[model samples]
Target chain A: MKTKFKKTLYSLSFFLLSICLFTVPTFASGLNWNGHFQTETRVNLDNSALTWQETNLTLQPEVVTNNTRFYGELCYRRSGLLSQNNSLLASTNSNPIELNEIYLDLYAYPWRRMDLRIGKQLIPWGTGYLLNPTSNLNPEDLRDVFDFGRYLGSNALKATTYLGEVTITGVFIPVFTPAALPHQQFQALFAPEMPSLPFTVNEQKIESILPAENLQESAAWGVKLEKHLLGCDFSVSYVDGRYSLPVPKITLTPVGEKVDLLCELIHPRRKIIGFDLAGAYGGLGFWSELAYFFPEEVKVTSDLTAIIGQHMEIVTLKDTPYAKYLIGMDYSADHLYFNGQYLHGFPQEQGKDKLGDYFLGRLEFTLNDGKIKIPFNACLEVRDFNKFQESFAYLFSPEVCFYPEMNTEITLSLRLIDGKSGTNLGKMKDWDEIGLKIKYSF
Target chain B: MMRKTCCILLLIICLTFPLCPVLKSQELTAKEILEKVNSLLNAPQDQKLTLKLVLIDKNGQEETRELIMMQKGKDLRMGKFLSPASQRGIGFLSLPNDVFYVYMPAFKKTQRIATRQKSGKFAGTDFSYQDLGTQQYDEKWSSRLVRAENEQYVLELQAAKGNDTGYSQLILWVSTENFYPLKIEFYDQHNKLCKVLTNHKIQKIAGYLVAQEMEMVDVIKNHKTKMFLEEVEFDTGLSDESFTERYLSR
Candidate 1:
């Protein structure tokens, strides 16, 4: 894996060098380079051990001509896997440098109001600040579990056309990529809690099944139509793709008094219909996002005693439609800013009958001419409204940021989470942590 | 002869009643003055300007920002930051009816700002969103002539009913020649002066009056922001499309 990564990096570097050499002759408005360097450290409150620490630098280079432009983002990382049993699996390609995004844009092509872009790019197709249910084209980036709203880019072709005040966007992606799971500790959160059985559990294993790249099903496409009216921005979209997260199919084998469970994780095919609106009235800014998902049926098979006696199957999921949405509002006055959102059903949740509700709020104060900022953020997840006290999970994080000079910032933050085990957030109750980050942009 | 005298007296009384108010006052009404100022401010169909903003702190330290501003009609305006790498690519669009939207380059997203947020500082500058917007004073403020001079008219403007603004009152010195404001004093709710704005180097550019240099001083904070016009163009025929979110994000 490391050798392959090095080869890819070398190829990319040579390609970028060639582009520079080619453009140096006809360069009028040449390439501009800028990005940032960041280092972050986090410590667990429960064990006082370093949970995460890394240093990375990103470089963004863009070349612009009159009608065409090229943009690229390259990141150099200095640290790899920390300590964990499955650290090798959790750490990414572990390359010294990775290409985050590269794309070429053609403006006013074919028509006066049309733009086309191709290559690895990010399509941020949602209006909500929280969980954007309308953003469905790209896979989720769970490298940092706390960075809740990040998405990975996709190599695709996109075209945008403006018809007066309306904009139409179409995208086609030929390949599918699964979500980047978090580190080993956080990756455990994706597993389902095992039910009590007569046999004592001994060992467990997970096997992930990804669709073959050559298959026709390993593709995604989406379209969006956006318009501004009534002093608001509105959009409707549709995506035909598969969910990036894997669902588990458990197979339990009993041996004497102990049992082993073989967990098979498979990506499910799904389609999404989404809509969103963003507008402000007077002193209040409001936004709403809605998405309905249609999924294919999936069954989990369990070996009761296939070698000794019998086989059984569980209908884990059936083809059903579920909805996810959020309504949010924000207001800023003087140096204070407040945002609140109520979300229904997280992206990982799939069942029509098993959706949860969450409330997210953030308050920030900027002082000393924006040299310092303090923000308090909170989230509450409720599995059952009737038993809110027993089936509720909550998290609180407060951060202080100081800007000592231009384009430089230092931030200190504390996060705490707690709840009963019934809620999803409760599974990570021991994740209380304190973190510090220093970032500088050029 | 007595009947002719009565008729003459009746006609004189009727004619003098209408002239009494005009004779007593030599100043234009607040509405009439505001209309004149609006007309002068919005004389051009569209305008494009390149400006450099210098911020001076109390400690004598200075920072600078560069931007391009576009305006169509009275209230449609868009501004994009061009320099100060941190603020570069940030843009805001203001349309009629107090609609506003801001684009953040890092997020690659556009957000609509609430009307009340107009009072907030823009991009860490001393100027608020309201100060940067191409505001129609006649639509937002109610005014009364405070003092008159040989070459200027002093007007006190109050926030109209149902209008929420950061300032309680503003004293404006309007030029008699072009009806353009030469200076303004901003007062807080306590009626204390907090900020002062002065325009200098007024020049006629392409048949329109333009201020070559402008400054806003926050007296309470002892800070100053000065803006210099690098390039100014009037009546450039900017379309409504220029004020949309597409261009703002671009």
Candidate 2:
């Protein structure tokens, strides 16, 4: 069956290639290429905490005209993780990390458009603030899916149709690294450090405990409605996907079996329903969104499955339902603009306290035709260990950017972390860092 | 027999002599037509004239405005207002390019109108910049007798060279009785019927005759506007500085 499916896919790809090669010359606008490279470094104030440094290089080659457009970007990144307290101790990749993005856009029709991207791309969806459909395939991280922010090297096909002021779009994701995979040689590529789990994870049962890796593919369809009326804008969407899973080792306990694992690599089927509302008038504007995710089934390993089957005493346990919401406002006049936003995520279903709740806020002020901008942001996550929520950690960052010209930008940023236990702010102030970056965009 | 012959001769001679008056009016020659029109146009150099101009469009809505026109030789200064808020000032001294300037109080500035914008609307009206300038009898038009109709010669005047006037050409009907232009139709650069210049305020100023009030309309936009000459003068001393760019920008 797998061989047959592969053959059919290969034949379809060949057909598409031929069509592109023959039809492209007649529809091409003009050839253009743009690229940029930048590197940034961060250090702690007391030189007593961890520092973060990274470099990014990207290039885009595009063809554009009155009706048709085709563009793609190639990107590379190199990062170094360091301990401020121990200056000599740091982890750096001996080689650079690279990702590719390529997409072809078809805008031939006046009412409908299509985009087919076959490589690394940002798949942002829903109106929620957190707990989104972010499937960053960090194979090295302990918590596979929910911990990371962006997915890499995923293939997607999207189609959008416009009717008056409303636009409806449909999308499909295929052959991406599944968020449920276990640690491997490329595990570090996902996140700097993986979170720790309470249960003992036997090497043999790891595969069974997680969904299939990049080998598992999924398809999702979504419908959205947007309307602008009475000085306010509103939109809502519903999305669903069916995914495959990878099997894991089964452990037998005397009182049946204990299964503690993450199943359904993507979800046999997952649904996202959300909406956004915004208003703009005079110098003030406000926007907000709320979204809820419903899964047909949540997978778990034999041990975790046995534990759940026995109704273990874990509060706000794994595979719990959740909801996310975000609100923001902006005011602008002449050359100056100020904006602020707050986002929150919490468990929607009772007795499922697996994922922690997060509160995030950001403020930005811009000056001089976007030539200078100051930004500050804070995020607090209340960790729910044993499904019992307790202490919270706050992450704060303040940054400033100066763009003298369209091609060049300079920025200074700082990162700080603080924690609180119950109503009292904890004494754990482990990390802080200051950073600078110079970027040239073409 | 001698008595009978005298009577017959007398009757025959009376009938033939009565036809002379009919023939004389038809003999309105080309030179005679041109001379009369030129003499009427040669109004006194310094006399200012006022008139109420009424413009009627294809839709038959008539717009009326008051105008003050002063013409000194080939130079002219004109001010027009159908209403208080719709006033405009124009000055043109015919030289090489017929240097023209228009003052719009709303903009608080005067603009040196180029030849291309000559056919555009004047002060948000159907009348174009070309419609604002005078169509001197001899300066712009070269006439040919198309045919004699009634007491007027329907002269078709082709625009003069170097003049390369805005109209592809202009056709005018001048009265043989006073050499005053009765009706003029202007064709655009594309040789399309663009405007109709109707003389409503035809009057004699000093020894010269002028259309004290006239109306011009755009055929496409269905708008009619009038230019009324309130005060007109012939041979007014309009200095070169009046048409300078600095003055125009002012």
Candidate 3:
């Protein structure tokens, strides 16, 4: 039976590969590739005492010729900080890092309407919306900078199929993490656990949750479905196995009058739902999601009381829900493109009564025989305490990008964030950054 | 004898100068070639075309399908591909960058695809996002005659002063005999050749001559796809409502 199963798997793979080789020819009529390199430095104009300098060099090479495709990227990053006497500071340190991404794509179609794609590539779930399936790796705000050279996703095997107006994608993610030396007597000291219960394996204690020794070696799976109907496009995603991190515990609830009550800690799972609509009349797009985390050992108790009492009564305890919603509209004008978006995120665990909100606006205009394209992007945030705490947390940002030629662009960005009366927010300072970038594309 | 030789040379120079002016006038400039092709394309009072397509690449493998096309002066109807689950049945594409509409037959509603998305693929075929538009070359492009080769004039065109198009420049080769387009190439803002369109199988239909088979290939990719027109009807009696979402759902 085992031999037969192995044979069947091999046969299936052979058949699929043959189909791809026949459908998508492996050669292009002309060879086309593009490479872009950018070096960026960030300085805090407000405080010379606190300064950060980083240089990033990235190279992306892609070849699309004949009917076959090939693409890969390589990147190196180095960052340093000079901290003088400050109220709160970590350590003055400089670090340089290098990373590598290598992958190839092959496409083929044997079935009448089905196309197969095999590669280690980023699989975006929604159409450049908030519920991005590939956001886990290359997380960037589309309104600000374009970081196409960043890693979009971990290495994975993926397949995409089209049925009528619906597109379905399935991916198998291969997780890989670095190994560390064995823990010696002193090395184990930082492990931190009760002497009797060295290396506690309790899934119940919300605050002290760690992954299994083989967590990074396991495989995760994700699937996405998209369809365009009427004037709207809708997509839903379900992913399992290590997609999201645990949500911090705000309170603990004890089990029913037992001598040893249950300590509850919960984290949210990752799930996404999104929709978009664009017609001749106008364009409306929206996306919303609910993520919940559940700690293994935590039991839901009556009138739960952990860490902070009664405050978490608002939270169901076992599964904490973190939610976000976005709505946008686009108006089609002859010489101008105008659009606006609203985003709101529900706090996961930081506070009981606060949620974050964002307002975004954009405009693009053309002139001088299509030689000059002027673009404007603006954003405003309200009640910004969703994932973390802040004293006067409000965010406002605006940017303008100009295209002098098809391959050339220059951008200027202005940003401001007002925290509460007192808070220690990391490298993020309330200041404006004016930088310039030039690109040569083929 | 010397005086006679000088007079004869002078006479020869005068005749050649006059002929140069006449010859320049006889030859069409780059702009004139573009205008000729545009005139022929826009001359048809009304036309409705339904054709079958067989897309083939360099490997000689092919996918067969059908499409219905219509054009009435400024209005037009491009092909609506109904195959493969991904593109299935989409709404017909209507023109003008402002009023571009796509009717989804499944939803029984016409949705408008964004203008920015017009450069994407159509029906998962080899055609580009911009190929679905009912763009009038004369209205959208300013033409200049580059040169003539093998009885066909090459025309270089830029987007007209008031028009907004994705391409920075386009080079088209038109046959002098019927003004039929033989081949065309599109360049992006970076002057990179992005798309190539070729017309083959020229035939005559109801007193109108046109290419019955055509292909649109992505020059930069290994994928070069073609669209073959089996039966083309030039002046079919198609109502304006045929282009409407109401009729599309039916």
Candidate 4:
């Protein structure tokens, strides 16, 4: 089965390459080819161990003919784990190449003010800088916390219409694609433990039932209306879809003296209503986004007879119509640019106290006629006030980028995670490291 | 003594009455000259142009970019970079009321450029975004004829109050006959000369006089950007819908 999958992947890659080479020159006047090749190396700070060495080559091609536009991006990546202690890559040995984006944009179809886009595309929503609570239409790939550019585009259809100063957009996603989580080996270290039992279980089984694409009811849809009003841009959007986060539907059984726990990962249905506004006053720019989510209740069961009667925990994920809002401002003085955001998650749940309020700030200074830049970014969790949680997870990344030419850049960055053990950022305290990247654009 | 006073008052009234029309006519002439300059610079409704930008540093190192630009009315302009391979598929759109957006192919995203950043260099060129847009001289600045020599009128322009502009004042050397701006000197907020723009070549195309080649030099940085108009079409029948974000991807 693995060999057959690999064969299929290789054949598809070759077919795409052949088509690109043959058709690019034929439509040279309307076709554009641009991409970059990058190499990166990262090492752990405390252990003095090499974490990963990776090389990536990307090819982006775009063709615009009349009212139709086609864009596609193919990326080939090769990564090597230098240390055996790195748990993130322990389950995988082969480096995979992937197609990042492929989409077609059709304009002036049916009407002059309307546009339709079909295929795999990035439908970014919301106004937050780092975290977008309202942007739930597309799943995110968050395996690497430091990599913010990777977003898994969804197979969807989008239509937008312009009416004078107002724009209305509608999106429909027929297939259900879940967010990719971190590697299992790394996740096992942070998995919450169930209540302990007196008797040992013989075997443990875990199952995940993903949302079925074949089911018509599993489809996701979103609508957004944006307009410029009162010297500010305002938008109201709503998404009706399955929650990207999985809920554990656990069943506990007692056979003889041992108890068996079966945990099933399920995606619950949810709805989100969001509003955002962005505007600028003089030299300062400001943006704000607010989202309210209504999620179904999740039920969890454990195999502990002594703790409770039946051992069932009813967890309400986003039970009370939770709201998350973020307000940010950006300003520039001379060569220094600063952006700060204050995020507040209202009415935080009991068990989800760790997912609290945060403040994110970024400062960038450009030098050498904008050729060289130094940026410092920091995120601090501010909700917890207890002594243990007082040392809440705070992540700081300082990076230096030097552009040797217009198409080439070298960057050096360091990620510092500070907090006590068992805190949010403290859990990944071992992953603190420095990285260097060099990229050349073509 | 009363008769002498009356004669003096009548002489004062006679002297000031005739000079008022002459002064009014001079003001009208200055305005007419500006209107002519505006007509030469602004398209009737829409325009299409192919432009080549060459950036030269103090050390003589040069970088060049080629692009095609389309403009609708006085507020909307879109530019697509065509050369340097890496810059291909990059699009810049400027809307009314100081809204600007840039789309990058690699990121596959369109980002808004803040109003404050409009005064910065445009794509690493010497020209700012404000300079690249259609020049609306009368809306932002008040002009007066300073002098006329050798068939050229030198006009001094001061920024109107409450206008957000990068420069405090500008002096333009315009041809008296054609009203085409031949040279301009920009002054900073402190009233210091900061940049100089000179038109090197002008050509008559389709019965319209246009500046074909121009150079802008930053006196402080000693950097220069030279622009060449390779192709131009006025009143190209472009619609307002084409300037909307719906067509930005194309």
A123-206 in candidate 4: lDDT tens per residue?
887766756666778876644445653567776889998889899999998767666555553453224334454556756777
TM-score of each: 0.88, 0.48, 0.50, 0.87
Q: Which stretches of candidate 1 lie over 4 Å from their true place?
A: A1-28, A78-93, A192-205, A250-262, A300-311, B1-29, B164-166, B188-192
Which ranges of candidate 2 are over 4 A from the true structure?
Answer: A1-29, A46-50, A82-100, A109-123, A126-153, A179-205, A208-217, A242-269, A296-320, A333-336, A346-359, A365-371, A380-392, A421-429, B1-250
Task: After the best TM-score superposition of candidate 3, give how far the Cα of residue B217 lies from its true spot, in angstroms.
Answer: 26
TM-score of 1: 0.88
Q: What is each predicted model's overall lDDT from 0 to 1?
A: 0.81, 0.51, 0.49, 0.74
Candidate that would win on TM-score: 1
CAPRI tier of model 3: incorrect
What are the per-model numbers of colliding residue pairs?
A: 0, 49, 39, 0
| Better TM-score candidate (1, 3) | 1
Error of 2 at A133 (Å): 7.8
lDDT of 4 by residue, B1-250 (tens): 9999999999999989756644544655666777878877764578888999998888888878898999887888998888766577678888877777777765655656677766667777777766776677787888888777666777889988855667889999887667789999988778899889999778778776778999999898888999999999988799877776566656
lDDT for B41 in candidate 1 is 79
Tens-digit lDDT track of model 3 for B1-250: 9999999999999979745533543476666666677677656656766656555545555555566666765555645654422233455656544456665532324455665545555544556446655546776787877766676767788877654456788999888777778998988767788789899988776776677777777665545666666555555566564454333432
Which ten residues in a row are the worst by lDDT in model 4 chain A?
A: A346-355
